[model samples]
Target: MRKSFCTTAILLAFGFVSSCGVAWSADAPLENSDCVKCHAKVVHENQADGGKHKTEVGCLDCHVGGHPPSTPKEDIIPQCSMCHSGEAHFELNNCLGCHQNPHQPLHIVFGDDNVAACNTCHPAQVNEIKDNPSAHGEFDCSLCHHDKHGYIPDCMECHEPHRPGQTYSDCITCHRVHQPTNVTYGQDIPNKDCGACHGDLMDTLAAGTTKHATLQCVYCHKDTHGYLPACQDCHGDPHPQLMMKKFMKCTDCHKDPHDLVK
Candidate 1:
């Protein structure tokens, strides 16, 4: 009878606190920044400044309305749909799951977030950036995609332009969005995946006298994978200087610059 009376007393106390709008914590869970310390710098690398984390908006402020497990990998973070009521995008698809980190929140490189995301407005480089394996694989999608849907970023808007010979008239010529690793060449630029576009180049390597014939175009065009070679850089006497001067344009004599000495 005494134990039952005590249980009733505890229930009445809990209800009174609940009715008073006061929260009862198991213990005060760590604030957002405190969580980041042990969680490492993996969550929000970009929000170091006056953004969400710096504003003292803790993890519980955003990761609310869900019960995350005690384990790290097993912890299911609350979806953005929970408290991101102020923002709007497509439907939720475990955004933070595939997206991985939220602190940097926009650098998606896996599927089509790279060159193509920018191409919704910058259509010029869409196809080329999509094909280059080296274009999208290395970087984060949010690095270039600073805006939401259909928003275009000027080249200098987010990043600086190129130098002397390296400047790209079309960013897609060398820059890819989806996977920085898969780049395609342009119209003026001869395509040379060796197997994909330059099957002829592969055939020559297969039946050639030189061992180099066995190599792919990308093998020689290393460094920046989307980059091509200048005939002037390699073989000193690759062609007659006098004839080259008269032509002014190398494509006239070379047919396809990638084909070379045909």
Candidate 2:
């Protein structure tokens, strides 16, 4: 009776082992399609606006090992550092603060205090404000870029236009946002634009009968904001040597460059 029981037990054990081997062999490896079955929303978001992640990577690439039942929750969700390393921008903490959605990585949203993070990625813009100090530079980056990560606020939002109907395009023509005080413009700038600040001077030049009255403000001012040219630079020694020595400066006789006392 004992010999018969042992033979039966051996046969049952062999049968169980054979069945398990067949089942394991038949099972397929996990794929992105498999992940999409459970994580449809996440997959959709990634597909729509995941930036480099959508194009360069796959679901299995970031999330390794296995899914929830087999893998720990922490192990399934990969850290940003795993791929984004060796850069100052990558070193910033709490990436989710600005990049609120990991799936839609490029759809960034800036927090109230994301200036530090902004400086890491855009040091040139930050340095421009630092190198040339102004009232605009004193405020936080969020103050102006309050809407989103890459939002550019209109100058009219904070400042009234120097003159009526001056568009935002007109603001950038002379004022660099980072270094607004260090005003600069091109030769094409009209006298009216300059008159926005120098109203009295524009009026004086307009009323005068001198040749300077007909010329554009940029003709004399050139590219720089507060540039003052010497009278001799344009009219080099207009008078004889004897007269030049007596009246060393053109302004001495001419009185004012804008409206010369002819």
Candidate 3:
């Protein structure tokens, strides 16, 4: 009975109800309304862009132990690992570095230098840039994706197009931002894009009377940059075997594949 009296006295000292043989006021859990009264802005921010936190959790879920007056400020605060464990991203230190606000976890932001931080969740893109070294690979991820997380800057922001009036879409069609130097494009790429670098070859191909003039540069060159296909790969032994033996190379007679002689 003395122990019960002591407990009741302690509860009363902390401004809790003093009724004996009844439910102790300390046992009564704090409602969402109780938290909202003090932390309306935090609650509102969480509801606005909380992602899963607004739907899956509540006030008491994270901020446990007790509120101030009964518990210290740090005692009530929760760590990210309390709920977000078991993943490589979760294991990473300094959740606040990128997340910034616990209320809106998904609203990620990056500082001027966050390449190492970016590599945690985006290892594929980071690895791709590292493996394939280009001018784009040398800097931090935030240099390109500045202002906000997931923001993809236009290639034209840092680089001039190969031709005038070329859009960001056109730049990505040939040059992947991560590995920009290794130029590759599809069949739909026009001859004008090739003309940007090889104007002489493009002019020669355009002026040629052969069927090759009707084809796109990619149609002959195919997948990647600097690929030179032999005439035999397309037009195999147009002449007799005796003539082919005498002239093993097609270019020896044709002179130029771009402007073939009739």
Candidate 4:
């Protein structure tokens, strides 16, 4: 009986070893020591990358929580920032309010649907863009204003520094975001509205007697953007304006100077 029992025990031990060889292989798990040495700085560095963090936060930080971090997956690891509730910028509603992406979150893009958020930090710029028909449209304001707390980028900073030949700093002069029609100093103008800026020239025409008097100044002036009108555009007379020096401009003899003052 004793001999039979020994044989049965030997067979059972062999069966157990065979079963262990067939189990699923796990990924090369991270050793606990490998994670502890540089955990905090890794988080900071990860956040620095502009893309949604591919790995800003480590498993130990999220999965381990307040306790000393362990590599064991079963340790009480937290998954999202909301659990802390005391983290800086935490009150910003969802974890994404300021930290847009969890994997590589550093950019603070202004939410297009939430102007109130941008207003909290950049009220002045917000107003300029909102009130001006030519400023940034629904595109997120932070798309250009990349920094935090009202950080506006100079147009030349992101674009090539204005070349020496460039004459102006008014980026708005051409980059009308609301409607990007390339309005240089020479196009897309409204002449009737010229009176809005040049009241004196308009007065001279309202009192003229010629075909020019019949045609509103804007009819021929068209939209030179902001340039002055040239007589060469309608009347072939290069001398018409110079005539003011010798015979008086065409307007003096043909159009009214005031109230059609003939």
Candidate 5:
């Protein structure tokens, strides 16, 4: 009985020590050198252009548990959401489809339905499209940025220029493409671009001998498209207050700024 009790005690002590050894090995940090031996390509690619992943975390931080000869593939490979969560885009299950490599997350190639995911980072552009919608806003972001991120598509790809010599820059000068209808431009824009739509008005303004004919459309239109500036803004009370009372509207006497007879 005494020998049996001693044998039982030894087995229990051995089991306790074995368990401690396993726990210590599991808790130990992985050696980078060992990881690189098997995953040289992944490690190299990550080191080159891993963005925040390379700078912020080590391989073991993501890969977690045991490696080859011990851990299963399921145990070694981490889900993107394990570290990247909370954002609307991160909630998407198939991050690898566009991102391609976890090592280089920003090396993206857009896939179908991926354009909506852009709203996660570009809320301002999305909101601009939503609030002031146009034909451009109706289409997916990928339709314009088909190649990659930060690509600016030429307006001519989808629509003809407003005028003969108009370039892509000219289109954006007066039109916010995301909300194309909300046309606004700086003072530098020539009268010809505006004349594309207002041809009759342009012809009248050009034929007139008045000082208004000498100015650009932007001079009176000022900040944005379709803006009709008040005569008082430029010609402040041309007659007297009593004379102004008789002709409340500037057009009553001027006929029209575009066709001023005087």
Candidate 6:
């Protein structure tokens, strides 16, 4: 009886082994084969919109192990830092919060907290906003660039122009949107651009008969906004030293540089 029981057990174990081996051999190539066959959607999207991810890397580079049913999910879905390490942004634990799809990494949609991630790449723009805080600085980076990366919002979408006939190009001429109050412009800026904001001051300067009337606003204001140049900067003590000593201030006699009479 014992010998008969041992023979039956041996046969059952051998049959099970043979069946498993046949199944593995039949399906092995398909199972552990090209990823695109099963994950076609992921592959397609990655190819179309993956940005640097598609161009720089491949499926096996990230997967790193056996495919699907043979491989555990944790092994298949890699941590971003596995490849993107050594950077400050890579140190962030939850990459998926902003970069929702690893397959298409640059298809980013960020919330308020995630906006700071922009500083990782756009440090200059972030610093410009920090150095000169304004209404633009109060909002997240995504607030303006809501569509995707590299999108520049129309200023008119949120702000009315200072006056009629002003354009998007005109707004940027005097205002750096990141640092809106730090209004600086090139010499090419038209007097009309300045007149849009300082109409009264422009009128006062234009109405005068002095040499100041012949000069453009920028000729005196020079390179920066709200910059006050000393009379000595150009004229170099228009009065005698004795008269300068008594009068002390050029504005005391000239009244206003914009509308100078004498």
Q: Per-residue lDDT for 118-222 in model 5, tens only?
A: 887898898888899687777788889984878888989879887798998888888888888877889998888889998988889999999999999999998
Query: Using Cα atoms with residue i matched to residue i, what is each candidate's TM-score against the true structure?
Result: 0.29, 0.79, 0.82, 0.31, 0.73, 0.71
Off by over 4 Å in 2: 1-30, 244-252
- The true-versus-predicted C-alpha distance at residue 159 of model 2, in Å, is 1.0
lDDT of 5 at 179: 87
Question: Across residues 21-124, which tens digit of lDDT does each residue of candidate 2 receive?
Answer: 22222255567765554456899888889898888888889889765434567888989999999988999999877778887787777767766788887889
* lDDT over C-alpha atoms for residue 20 of model 3: 26
Assess each prediction's global lDDT (C-alpha) against the native.
0.48, 0.79, 0.79, 0.49, 0.78, 0.75
For candidate 4, write residues 1-262 as lDDT tens digits: 3234324433564432332222211333334344323244654555467253334435445445322222333555444653545633344555466656554555555454555665555577667666765535556766665647466466665455323333234445445543434454333333334555567777767656655666655455444454556455665765545556776455666443233434
Angstrom error of the Cα, residue 129, model 3: value is 1.6
In model 6, the worst 10-residue window by lDDT is 15-24
Better lDDT candidate (1, 6): 6
Worst 10 residues of 5 by lDDT: 15-24
lDDT, candidate 4, at 157: 55
Clashing pairs in 3: none
Error of 4 at 72 (Å): 12
Superior by TM-score: candidate 2 or candidate 4: 2
In candidate 5 the C-alpha lDDT for residue 17 amounts to: 34
What candidate 6 gets wrong by more than 4 Å, as runs, is: 1-27, 30-33, 50-57, 67-71, 230-232, 237-262
Provide the lDDT at 42 for model 6.
87
